[model samples]
Target: MLTSLYVRHFAVVEEAEIGFGPGMTVVSGETGAGKSLLVDALLLLSGARADSGMVRAGCERAELAAEFDLSALPEAREWLRQEALDEDETCRLRRVIRSEGSSRAWINGRPASLAQLGELAGRLIEIHGQHEHQALLSRSHQLALLDAYAGHAELVQRVRRLAQEGRALETQIRALQGEEDHASHLALRRHELTELERWALAPDALAELEARQRRLANAGRLAEGIAHLGELLDGEGELALRRTLARAQGELTRLVALDARLEPWRELIDGAAIAVDEAADALRRYLDEVDLDPARLAEAEEHLARLHELARRHRRPVDELGERANELRTELEALEQALAGLDARLAERDRLRRDYALAAAELGASRRAAAARLAADVSALMAELGMPGGRFEVMLETHGEDTSLDLLGRERCEFLVSANPGQPPRPLRKVASGGELARISLAIEVATLGKDSVGTMVFDEVDSGIGGAVAEVVGQKLRALGSRRQVLCVTHLPQVAAQGHTHLKVSKENVGGQTRTVITRLDEAGRAEELARMLGGLEITAETRAHARQMLERAQAD
Candidate 1:
């Protein structure tokens, strides 16, 4: 609840601090007394746009601060916990408006933004006025109100969670479909990979084929060189080196036999003769085997050309062609497996959508029942507020069209109203008069109070229309509402003002030709005088005072 409010340097307010409690507090005075100015300051503190005219005439700036006790609001406390903004059990909201038309806002004494303050203020208080009939015009607000009234916020939350899950699953299905959509790419990749696999090129195979081509290109020259060497080494009739070495070996043996010291030369001669004979035999065999075959050379060149062509076709280094082929094969197989997985995922996504639909259906059913009960409750309260024959209705409509193999689950709900019997209930915007609408708005507030968690409800001229009994009933409702939270009502009706737990009289006073607004708490006699003044105009007669005292006594007794 709002524990305190301080206004400094505001229009006609100068400086004032008001203490609040957990019950109805009434602010009353004649016209132009700055009573509503207090409400204006509070609205600004709650994140309303600021106006430079609100600053005191002689001051450079205006400041407003309001305190809230959050010990009882667990939701707000948890939010504060998540944001790390809590300080003990209190939250302070402040706003400063400068004469230059600039404004600053704060929460918990730290610099803050208007949006932050507004978000927190929404949970802390609800200010209802004539302009908020737009909320009645909104379908979302209607559903929220009825959901709050029927105590089905939990189900609404469940449905929201399921909706989120369903959307996530649907996103995955879309991504899978995107992969499946590239069918042409998949087919082309498979065909290319299969062709590469069939070739099974080996590393350096191109270089090996090139080397064979070189060997074939020089085969005739190689064979001719070997045949000429064989002829010189004894393949033809000539004195070969091997025959000359053999004759020299026999002469050395004769000389070594004559001289015993010459035995090393005999051993050398024998080894040389053996080496010469082996060389002659190898030369004869070389001449026999050396022959050029152009057919085989052509075969080798063709093979090399084929290898080079394949390397060109694949657009890779010949050595890397093998690795590229292996990689392509792996990818093609993985894509084939991924397609199967995509199908499975899409099927699972379909099942998830069905589950979401079932959950939403259940949620819609609960909301339907809840809307009826809420309409009944608010209608009853409205009747007690003196609109005896008013009719209230809640309507729901479903969506159509199937998407992604599943139907979407959703519906629109509207609040309908009729001011009197024999009249058909239409949309709230079309059917309700200003007074009836204000009262209806209050009844809805009252119906949703326990679940709303707002610490204060400010009624701006809620007692504007109707009189006598209806006014008392409005006062009683405000009082009962105040039992759970604080309520501040601005009113001219003495009956409504008299019922306040604390009565404040706002008046305009002048000192030294400067007009200012003043507020004072009225005691019992003061209350009577005020009520008598309300009832009897400017004359305060003895009978009028008696009647005022009696009215006070009865009001206080209740």
Candidate 2:
């Protein structure tokens, strides 16, 4: 439940800290005294849109805060725990609106987004504006209210989920069936695969083939070069390296016999002659192996040209042709598998349809049961709220079996009403007067009591278009609802104001030449004076004061 609200530089409210208690609390004041400012403040704290105009004239920003006790609100506590914003059993929500049209929010002193604040606020309080009856006219809103009253959250969510899944499955099925030309696609892929396979070459094999081509292409040059090298190393001419080295070695041997130091030089010349002989042998072996084969070279060049052409056609590197062929093979396999799996997918779609039908059927049945109870309860409350013969009904119109899946179940919900006896119940939006709509809306709200999990319910002038006994009944209904949950009502009706377990008086004052709105919690004497002011209009007489006191006493006695 809401524990307190703090506002500073917010609109005409310069600064105010008001503590709230459980049960019905009525806020009353003269018109234009900013009676609904409290409600507006709570709305802003709940993440409503804010603007620079909401700030006071001399202030840079508007600050609003609300505190809640979550001892009985497990949902709120769990939400706090999930968000890591839990601070014992109390939660504080703060919002700052700058004069520049930017705003910031916090939950338990932790910076939070507007969406987060709204989400948490939803679990803490529910504010019903004076114009809420306007929304109640919408068929969708009516259905939502019925669902809430029926405690069909889990069931409605299930039906919606099944319907969504079924629609998604239907979309998949359509996409699969839309592939009517799959056979042609498969044939094209197979033809491409076959072409790729025909010229597929491993990377290493391609490298080796290119090397062989280079070697074969230069065979004549290589043989000529090797023959020249052999002549230079071991030819029979006197100038050849081998003969020169041998003659040098003979001379060195003759010198070595004269001096032992010359023996090492003679051994070095012998090693040179042996190295020249080894070179000549190696050149002879290489020249013997050299082949001038144009046919093999031509074959390798044509193969490479074809591979490059294929790479150009496929927009891939020549080395990646093998990988491309593998990819095409996999695609062909998938095409075959997709064709084989079509029947299975169709079967699964059927299963989803069946599941959706079952869930929607159950939802429809529950709605019918809940609708009966809700209509009866609202009708009974309508009689007590000064509509003697009025009747309320929840009409469900079922859709055809072939209709597309709907997230709101298989039927359309419409609220119908009859304001007079012997009259047929008509759609609420078309027939009910504004006062009647307010009463009926209140009746529905009262009928659905205890169904909402929100701990606090705020009604901003919910008694807008009714008066006298009807207003009294409205107050009683709110007071009764407050017994189970906290309720705050902003009203001008004396009867309604007198019904509050606590009363707050809103008044405007000019302080320091600046207009400000002030809210004061009323003691018994203060309550009587405020009520008398509401009952007596601009002036309060002794009789009006006595009447106000008696009204408060009577409402409390009840």
Candidate 3:
């Protein structure tokens, strides 16, 4: 429900705030008193189009802001949650329209697009008038209302899920069908992978063999270095030292006499001779261990080349050749099974389409049944609203030849009405009289309000054409409707205005050469004056005031 509406610099309303409560609320005013201005601002807040001409003459821009208490409206909360915009259990819709025709929207303090604001506000309020009641006359809207009346949301949801699944299946089938002419293309790709599949490659075989090849290519230098080292350590210096030491030892016997240092020199030469023999033995062992093989190295290099070439062609690492082979083999198996799987999927799609047709047909039958009840209830209300024998018809036409797939369950529907008794029933849009049409439309709306998500219903001058008892009946009905939903009525009739749980009167005044609109909530005494003014026009007679007081007392008694 709307908590308050604030309009700043909009039309004749420089700044105004209107608070609303539940049950029937009536707004009464003299002509050109800005009651319609209040309604217009609300319409903009509800996502209606804005006009630059309505901006206050001196203001650069006009701002329209409306606050709604949505804690009780779970559907709206859920919608906001889905859109990720629910904040503080309250929805604040604001719009800024520049005098240059630029407009902007905000939801919950976040800047939003006008389209988004419109969608969000659509779930909040519904304004019904003689001009906008044509929405209930829309055939598609009527079908939705009928479905809602039938309480078949679960059934419709099931159908919706089925329809969604059927669409997905159809898309998959078409994608597979598009691939039907690609068998030759697939075959070529398979052959390419198969060519690269037959390779016997081992890792690092090339690098290891090349290292061994280099060693073999330098075998002569290694052999020469070994021989030269053996000659220097054994034959040249170590052997000569051993022979000289033995000679010195033999001479030392006669000169043991000369010094003990001579004896130490002989012992050192003996150690050197042992070292020379050990070095020559190690060199002989080293020469015996080197075996070079060029042919084996060549074979490794050739195999490495084949693996590298295959890897490059496939854009893979050389070590990944084995993995590539396995992948290609698996893909070949899948290709062999593709035809069977595609056939099964296509068959399943057809089966779901048949199931969808059956379920949707049942739903369509249920909607038709519900539509009849709706028309009867609305037709009854039309009679009570002073349009006796008004004919309200719900027409459902089946479209397309019988087929598995269809457009919107293949049903085209229309809601038709005739306002007068014995008058040929015609399309509602063809009606000429405003008040009769307004009543007929409201009757249908009240009947279908249960199916509609509109939390607030505003009726502008719907009680225009009738008076007295008829006016009382209209007020009673509007009041009765208040038990189920919020209703705002703009009226001049005392009985109608007196029907409200809260009444507000709009009046105009001239202050400093400018006309301004003022809205005041009527207290007990003020209520009598306002009601008296409504009953007796500009002059409030004593009798009229007394009558107004009595009317207020009677209204309160109810």
* Winner by TM-score: 3
Tens-digit lDDT track for model 3 on 1-558? Answer: 888988888887778788988988889988778776776777787677888987888789999998888876787899889888889789999999999988998999988887777677767876666665345556666667667777888777777777778777787667656765557857866876766655534457545655766667666777888877766655556455445555655676556557766776656666766776777789888877654566755755665677778888878887777778778778767655665578887888888888878878988898789878988998898888878788888778886665545535656667788887888777766677767776776787678654576677777787888988878777877877776778888887888888888898888877788777788888888888888988896677899999999988887678
Worst 10 residues of 2 by lDDT: 128-137
Model 2, C-alpha of 171: deviation from truth (Å): 3.4
Off by over 4 Å in 1: 78-85, 133-138, 180-344, 399-409, 420-426, 429-434
Residue 231, model 2, lDDT: 82
lDDT of each: 0.76, 0.86, 0.76
**Model 2 spans > 4 angstroms off:** 1-3, 44-52, 67-125, 132-138, 151-158, 183-339, 399-403, 417-436, 453-455, 523-529, 536-550
Put the candidates in lDDT order, highest first. 2, 3, 1
- Residue 417, model 1: lDDT of 77
What is the Cα-based TM-score of model 1? 0.67
lDDT of 2 at 182: 80
Best by lDDT: 2
Better of 1 and 3 by TM-score: 3
